[model samples]
Target: MDNLLDFFKAYDISLSQMIIVAIIFFVTIAMELSIRLFFRRYEKATQHSHTIKILFYLSLNKPLQLATMVIGFYFMAMHVLTWFRFTSFFDQVVTPGVELGLALCFFVLMNTFLSRLKTYSITKKTRTDGGYNNFAKIEQIHKLGQALTIAVMVFVIAAILGLKVAQGVAYLGGGLAIIALVFKDTISSVFGGLIIYLDSPYAVGDWIYTIDGTIQGTVEKISWRLTHIRTFDKRLIFTPNNLLITQAVVNASRMSNRRILQYIGLRYDDFDKFEAIQKDIYTYLGEHPDIDQNCLTLVNVVNGSTDMGSTTEGFFGGSSLNFQVYTFTKVTNWLKFQAIQDKIMMDIGRIIYRHDAEIAFTTMTLDISSEGAEPSPQAT
Candidate 1:
């Protein structure tokens, strides 16, 4: 050690300066090794914390490296300036540069930490509660958290650089109009996203139908600007948030009960048994386990209503009879709802057969007279 000190002294370097350099070098190496060992043990002990581990390593490594380099550079400059010709440039320019680097490193570290914490909290909540797994809500929270972090980091960095906050605010105010004009759509989308997060018209995994019939699908994800949907045909659609805000969305998955409204027509010959058929169908629907008992279930013959008999006045002279079947299923699942509907339809067909009724169809009869004879009116 003495020999090394003497050798540096020959080059006009102080023993204390050389000692500090060596200490910093060895300390950096030790820190690197310590970091590796700790991470290895931590990963082995808690593999479930893989996300946290990856975040920690990502947020830690670069900042530490940059900090080490900045410190070394600062001390080296100070020591070298003491021996050589010194100038105020080191104190004025170089010192501020080092401080800026350190401040940047700190900002990066904190930003990364906040991002990781946001992710970790979201993941933890998802594991605890199914509702917390709402992708739209979680995505909104993450975006807000990241925006706040960036804003804070900006202020902190400005302070470190000795820039006046008031001046920056004034400049921002001056440019507000231009910024607003340039990002009008983005601003609208951000507010739209906020509204969606708060109102929660639908969540991820929900089956949605737009009132305009332009979109119908399952919501797969919701980001800041767009909502992603997967259609039944396996096609993907990305809808802007602003458009969702303005349009009416029907959340099929959110319905408490699915309704089946049907009209069955029978031939005029079976009109006598129509009443019994309606009663039987109503009884079947009432006894169905999957049918919602609380909701209205109606099975009625159509004849004298203003629109029913009035519309049939021109055709068949109101002789046709139609039965209306209306009921709500207890389940909201699409596939199960379809199955229930199929079963109910089959049951109705069987009931009609048992009642000795035949299904109705539009028909017309024509009469042919010898070529020159007067044509008779058609019967429909």
Candidate 2:
């Protein structure tokens, strides 16, 4: 040990400077790389093969290597200073120059990897279902992470290379009032995206019932700026995500299918014969390969009023069958739902007609005795 110290002194090294050199070699470089390599090998073994594996490793290795080089350079520089008795020069010369640049580079690299790690974690969480996500939400997150990483790297590297990012920040802050006035929607949208990810009220393919009377058929897509819903009628509705979050959303397809109800009214006079009429209708629907269950049907309990609780009869009145067919379509497919409904309607009409019962229609009877004075052609 004494000989090594004497030799370093012979080669121009002080005790404190020598200690820094050893620390940089063992701690900053050797130990750091050893730890990184250990994790790398372990990760490669356990993780499934992907085309991105090579690129990911290279990305990590580059920083690991660059860090090693940086520390090694400092060690060499320290040795020079110690040997030449230039310690004062080292402190005076390196701080504002080398140290700042080193620190900035480290910060940028560390931030980039941190961003990547977060992206990977979120991707894993999104794949909790293990089923393939056609929506590719996780993949999109990864892409966004990549973009942000590059942006941050560019920004920091620019400052390190002496482009004065702090000056830019100052100017930006000075003009923030103008920016806010001009880009209010843009700023709000960024915050809205954060809320979306945190709250996760609904995902793609969910059927959302808006409180404002608009029934969004399915979530076609969701972006940072907008949420798109495809209506049952094949129309697309683009809503700002911010506005959507503020509104009440009824998620029908959240872990389950939606329910649809239908009501049909038959003439009140169809009764007595209605009991037997319901028999075939119920049997067919019960045995139906598509109808959900035997829970779908009803007989005539016709209240003598409009079907929709209308107090006045306009051009319609009848002894209605008052059939309440309630069946859930097993699938969330709108087309399938409509097809099943059409079949049910057809069957109901055929059975009613086959039973020789008339579907009631509105009627008005005026006694001719009182109207004889003016039996107008319009009335006739």
lDDT of 2: 0.63
How does candidate 1 fare on TM-score?
0.62
What TM-score fits each model?
0.62, 0.48
Off by over 4 Å in 2: 1-185, 204-209, 214-221, 228-238, 251-255, 258-260, 294-321, 364-380
Quantify how close model 2 is to the true structure by its C-alpha RMSD in Å: 12.5
What tens digits encode model 2's per-residue C-alpha lDDT throughout 19-54? 767776677667677857876786687566433453
lDDT of 1 by residue, 60-95 (tens): 755776687777778777767666547587877778
RMSD to truth, every model: 7.5, 12.5
Error of 2 at 177 (Å): 10
Clash count for each candidate, listed in order shown: 0, 7
In TM-score terms, candidate 2 sits at 0.48
